[model samples]
Target: MHNVSHGLNDIASILSNPILNTDSYKASHYLQYPPEASAMFSYIESRGGRYGRTLFFGLQMLIKEYLCRPITPAMIDQAKAFFTAHGEPFNEAGWRYIVEQFGGYLPVRIRAVPEGSVVPTHNVLVTVECDDPQVFWLASYLETMLLRVWYPITVATQSWHLRQTIRAALEQSSDDLTQLPFKLHDFGARGVSSAESAAIGGAAHLVSFMGSDTVLGVVAANHYYNETMAAFSVPAAEHSTITSWGRERETDAFRNMLAQFGKPGAIVSVVSDSYDLFAALDVWGTELKQAVLDSGGMLVIRPDSGDPQTIVLQTLRALDASFGSTLNGKGRRVLDNVRVIQGDGVNPESIAAILAAMDEAGFAADNIVFGMGGALLQQINRDTQRFAMKCSAIRLGDDWHDVLKDPVTDAGKRSMKGRLTLLRNRHTGEYRTTTLPLEWDERTAESDWDDALVTVFDSGKLLIDVSLTDIRHRAHAHEG
Candidate 1:
C-alpha cells in the first residue's frame, strides 16, 4: 500500500494552528509567480510554449486521497496524539474549524492562464484567493499539494521544445510537415518514478506529439483532460519477443513479424540489434527482403545500442543501399519501404545532432523516428523551472497591505508584491504580470491589456475544464 504519511512533513502538524497570530487568520493571501524561472532552458527561444497544465490535477487527487471525505473523530484524535507525542500542543480549535468548514471543498478561488497558451517566464501562471478570513492561510497550507503541478508542466514544456526542434528540422528537409506530430514518441513510462508520474508526464508529452507507447499516459489524459485517446503506438517487437526465437531462428522472427502485421499499409517495428544488427539488416536485405517487399507494410528497423548519431546514419545508409531510394523534392533520399527508429541516446542536444547528421548524409528527416525514455520524464525537477508559490498581498480587517520578501542575500529569491494579474500585450503577444492594489477592479483594467488569467477554480468546483484536443490545437497553432 502507498503510505500517505510519508508524503508530508512534521510542520504539517501545525498547519491548522489557530493560535498562529490571530491577525493572520483574517488576512487574505495572494499567490504570485516571481521572476527567477528563466534559467531552466539553454535559450530563451526554447522556453516559449504553453504552460500551466495539470492545474487541477494535483488538487483533485489530494481531495480524493486525503480531504474529500468527512474528518472522523479517530482522525482528529490521531492528529492530537501525533503532536502531543512530539511534545507540541495540539490546536483543538483549529482542527475543529478544518473539520467543520472544509469538507469535500476547498475555500479558495484560483485564477490561471488557460491551459496550453504560450507563457513566458516570470508571468503569474496561477493565483489563489480565500473568501473567508479565517481560511486565508488555507491556500498557503495547500502549497505542498498544489506544487505537484510542476512535474507535468515542466515535462510538457520540455516535450514542446523538442517538438519545435523536430518541426524545424522537418520543415527544412521535407515537404510533409503532417508527420511532425509523430516524430517524437514517448517511451518514458517505465523509467519514471511511479505509475502516477508516468501518467502525468506521459500525458504532458502527448500535448505536442501523437506517438507514445505509454498507455497509462493516454489514460491520464482521458481522465484529467477529457481526452478519449490522446496518443498512439504501432505493433512492435522487443528483444524478448525476438530473442525467444533464438539467434539462429532470427530470420524466422523477422519473417513472423511481416507475416502477422504485413497487411496493406500496416506498420511494425523490430529491434534489429538483439544479435548482430548488421547481420539482421543483411537478412532483411537478402533472405527477408522478398517478404518485406511483398508484405505491403513499412518495416521500422530499431537500433538499440551504439553511438546514436553515427549508428543512425550508418543504418540509414545501409537501409538505402538495400531497399533502394528515391529523391524527394528537397533532394533528400527517401528509403523505399523501410525506416529507422533511434530510441537510444535521444535527448534534445543529441536529437539535434542526429537530425543534422542525417541532413548531411542526404536522408530525409521523415525517414526516421525518435523515441525517448528517462530524459523525457525523470530528468527534471521543480528547480528546473524555479517554480514557487508566494504571498504577495494580505488583507487585515478592511485594509490591504502589499507583502514581499526581498532578502539581500539572493535577489532571485525576492518575491513580487501586491495582488497580481497577468496581461498580454496586444501587439507583441507577450505576457507580463501587473501588480495591482487589492481594491483595483479588473473591469477597469480590461481595456489596455487582455487579462491572460481566467478563473479556473472557485468555491470547490472546477470552472474551466479544457479538452486535450483543444489544448493540442492551441499549443501548435502558434508554432509558426
Candidate 2:
C-alpha cells in the first residue's frame, strides 16, 4: 500500500489500524456523527446479524451514488474492503450512520401522488410490496424514512389545501385570487431541522404552490421549474445594540439596509414587528414606497407580531388609505407602495381566519402576501383525516397473513393485515381501495384494477427516476 495520501487520510487511517477493535472504532465514528448512526446500528445490532447485513445493504444502496464516484466494481470493492478492514463492528456502525442520514425505506411499493397531493387518511396512495423477502427485516428501519417523507407531504398538503381554500373563497366571496403575486416561502429554517430538510420541505410546498426563502429549496424545486430561482430576503441583523443607559439608536439601519439591498422590489419582506410594527410601517411607508418605485420594487412589510389577522387588516388599511390614490390598482397601491405580509404565527388555521376577517372587513385581498413558517412546514399535526398508513398484509413463512387493527373509536387507529392491492378507477381517476393476494397484484398482467400501486423502490434501490418536479407537477395537477 502506497503511503501517498490523497485527502482520504482520515478514512484511510480508520481503515488501517489493526489494533483498532471494531467496537471502539465504531464508537469513535458514532461520536463523530452521533445519535443517528449509533442509534440505528444499535437497533439493528439488537436483532443480531440478521439485520446488520440488511442495514448495511440498505445504506450501501442509499449513499452509493453520492459517496461512490460511479459505483463501479473498483469503487464497490474499495468500499467493502475499507469497511471490512476498519473491522466489522465499525463497518456496520458506519453503514448504519449512513443509512440514517440518507433516510429509510418503505415497504409498500409506492409512487407518491407528488408532494402536495391531498392524500386522505386510510388511502393507501403509497404503492408498496413485499417484493423482496430477503429485505423483510428492513421494514422496521423503513419507518424512519416514512416518517421523514410524511412530514414534507403533510406540510405541503396542508399548504396546498389552504391555497385551494383561498382560491375557492376568492371565487365565492368576490375576492380575486390572482392578487397573490408573490411566492409562498417556507421560512421555517430557524425552527426546523437541518438546512436540507427545511429546503426539501420548502420544495415540497412549491409542488402545491411556489415561494421559498431557502436557497437549497430553490435548487431542489428549480430542477422542476426549469428556471433559476433566487432567495431574496433580509439578513438576520439587529439595528440597535444594548448599551448601559437603556439607549436606542437607528444606526443607519435603513441606509445600511438600502446599501446592501439597494432599491428593493420583487418580494421584498421587511420585519416591521422587530420593534413596533405599526410604527415601523408609519415611519417607513414613505421611504419604502419611494425605494420600491425608484428601484422597481414592491415593498412587502412582514408584520410578525400581534394577531396576524388583526395586524394584516390594520396594515392593509394603513397601506391602502396612505397610498391607495397614489397607486393605479384599486387595492394594489403603486404610489405609497407597500404590501402587508403576514408572518410569525401565520399557520393554516390563522390564515383561514385572517382571510375571512380581511374579506369581512372588505380589505384588499391583493394587497396581502403570506410568509409562512411553522404552520406550513413544521408538520404541525397529522391532519391525516383523509390519509392513512395501514399494514395491508404480513407474510409469514411462505403464506401471507392479513391482519386488521380496527380502531375501537376515532382515537384508536386501525390497520389491515395481509397482502393487499389498491385499485384506482380509470373513469373517475380516484383511488379504489381493496385487498387481494400479492401474487395477483401485477399491473402488467392487464388486471381489471386500473390504478395499481407499483413498487418504486425494491431491495434498497429506486425502481424509477422520478424528479422532484414530477412530484410537484403531479401534486399541482391533482390539486387542480
Each candidate's root-mean-square deviation in Å? 7.1, 10.2
Q: By TM-score, how accurate is candidate 2? A: 0.66
lDDT of 1 by residue, 1-480 (tens): 122452224444334422221233222222221222110000011112244322212333222333333444445555555545545555555446656777525566777777777677666777777646544555565555556667777888888888888998888888799999999999998999998788888888888899999888888887777777788899999999899999899989989999989877999999999989998888889888888899899999999999999999989988888999999889888899999999999888899999999999889998999999999999888867777777667666655567777989977777777778778866677777776542455665555467777877665567777788878887877776
Off by over 4 Å in 1: 1-92, 102-104, 437-448
- Window of ten residues with lowest summed lDDT in model 1: 37-46
Q: Tell me the whole-model lDDT of each prediction, alpha carbons only.
A: 0.72, 0.47
Which digits, one per residue and each the tens of the lDDT, describe model 2 over residues 390-451? Answer: 44454555555554657567534555444444565555555544555435546733544464
Candidate with maximal lDDT: 1
After TM-score superposition, the amount by which residue 255's alpha carbon in candidate 1 deviates from its true location, in angstroms, is: 1.1
What C-alpha lDDT, on a 0 to 100 scale, does residue 326 get in candidate 1?
90
